[model samples]
Target: MSASQAAEVVRMGVLGHVPPMSYRNAQGEFVGYSVDMARAVCQDLGWTCQWVPTSLATVADELKQGQLDVAAMSLLSTPERRSHMLFARPYYTSISAWVARPGVALEAPGTRVAVVQGSAQARFAQSRQWTLVEVKTHTELAQQLAQGRVDGLLAPMMTVVGLMAAQPLQSLQLQVQPRRDPELTGAASFGISPMRPELKPLIDGALERLERNGVYDKINSRYLPFKVN
Candidate 1:
């Protein structure tokens, strides 16, 4: 393809999260790491990038329909996902964790862990032998924890930390250990549509450059909530 064709605008889907990516500010603007990273790539290529909000369950369908060129949201690379879409080299590693209300200890066999259905955390919980109660979203799991619907929740350690900081839940706590299988760590990578093979290299190269230059570290630091426990 010519340089102009390569620089054509792409519609990148994203999800709302903490600042420096796709967070909804008090003014209600969506911004954060994924957004900044996507924006940087667009600026470098002089391309116009559009952000589409989507849930994890529907991203694959959207990509398949060609409604999206790429997905900036984080999803684990499973054989199932690989069959339908391509993934960029990992941009961030989210430590999977078991979170619970303060004072409730989480044990392998006896603990009831709430997880988002079809999420990495849910899969990890299954592998770890936790009794799983599948919910729809991280926020929903948090609600269950608040309501005593379950013993604890499993999710990315960073997300647990961020939630604790932003919500200041005295009951919520997180436990993280090195993943035993290594492959189950559930680190995040960008998902690309198979139809847009060209966009993969363009976006992946920009991500590689950003990681090498410490841009990603800075972005993570800004969003990661510091926890004492």
Candidate 2:
């Protein structure tokens, strides 16, 4: 391939801390359900894939600034976000839940809730006028909940479950409220940079092909206990 052609490969950004979905491992490699799916899509299109590790707090800005070609992290489609970037076809269903110690009133006035910055849960907390303890990553959000620094945590249900099984949190007996917030429940899709409008069709087609060929299901099963699509 020519230098210009090689340079045209997609620069996909992924969260560095959200495990089982998209994260950078201990070995410094990006591996997770989202990463696998992105790779499959790029491979199908015969496009080189360059993975960029990023935090959820900055991904949207990065995309809007053209610093990244695609946001491969589990980004939920929202009207507010749609104004900043384009989203590919929906890949998975996203639902968020509240986690807290038993007997803690999550809906009480001035209840401090921890939420990952730039996430849908954060917006939900803000909309409800809940005191927000904004965090940059899922690991920090989990740490705040485990350390009792926050009254509750509002995050994706699957992410909450994954973090609960990790260190510094596994022993804590936390109550997970059922997901019911319409703002936090919706289809998650890849956020394509507005600068790369051409990527929308390419990524959408690749994802559709993967789904039809069962590759999407295989990747989903490899990382999650339940199907997200």
Candidate 3:
């Protein structure tokens, strides 16, 4: 569309947590794979978009309240989540891993583990019968591992990778659980708010084209070392 048609700005809600996906960088700008992908979608659709940084808990509320048109924070399309919001084609898949300090053999069922607040890791940890500790933020999760408050942190692999890159914890080891399968793997889609049915296909179309043209990989690989597809 021409500039006149792009006059209206799209409001997108993004994650303020979760590195390599979406997070406020040291420069205070919200930049990551998810952010860049959303920007590309908006650009392809000829819409000017404003990214609003939000947490996982509030992003759904923001979308429900009609304050945001899209929530592009590597959102998993679970049954509960699909009840109200719509999802565009998945841009990336999320995988879970266990991060532990050095010399900590945490492969047993009763090992103590920490999870970020309101994360899918909680359910997996519970399923394994591991003792659980909940931290509200990524930094707190790291602190728990460092202080020996927990044996390890069960978090997203991308997040664990980012942590390992930023601060090379000498003892930190990111390991995949033995039982990891469908339950532990989920697609991370760009969630759309309801009442804007027209926007879904437009974003999806843009995403399809971006992926076909290899733009998606470039954007994704910029923040994450591995391809999540």
Q: Which is the better candidate, 1 or 2, if ranked by lDDT?
A: 2
Q: Which scores greater on TM-score, model 1 or model 2? A: 2
Q: Which runs of model 2 end up more than 4 angstroms from their true locations?
A: 1-7
What's the C-alpha lDDT at position 165 in model 2? 76
| Per-residue C-alpha lDDT of model 1 across residues 77-114, encoded as one tens digit per residue | 87767877888777766556666655666664768888
- Give the winner by TM-score: 2
lDDT value, residue 219 of candidate 1? 68
Error of 1 at 215 (Å): 2.6
Give me the overall lDDT of model 3.
Answer: 0.75
Question: After TM-score superposition, what is the CA distance of residue 128 in candidate 1 from its true location, in Å?
Answer: 6.1
| Candidate 3 clashes between residue pairs 3 or more apart in a chain or in different chains | 102-171
TM-scores, all models, native as reference: 0.81, 0.94, 0.85
- lDDT, each prediction: 0.68, 0.86, 0.75
lDDT over C-alpha atoms for residue 166 of model 1: 51
Taking the tens digit of each residue's C-alpha lDDT, what string does model 2 give over 118-148?
Answer: 8899988898867999988899988898788
Across residues 152-193, which tens digit of lDDT does each residue of candidate 3 receive?
887777777666665535455544443255666888888898
Q: Give candidate 3 misplaced runs (Cα > 4 Å).
A: 2-5, 102-110, 168-179
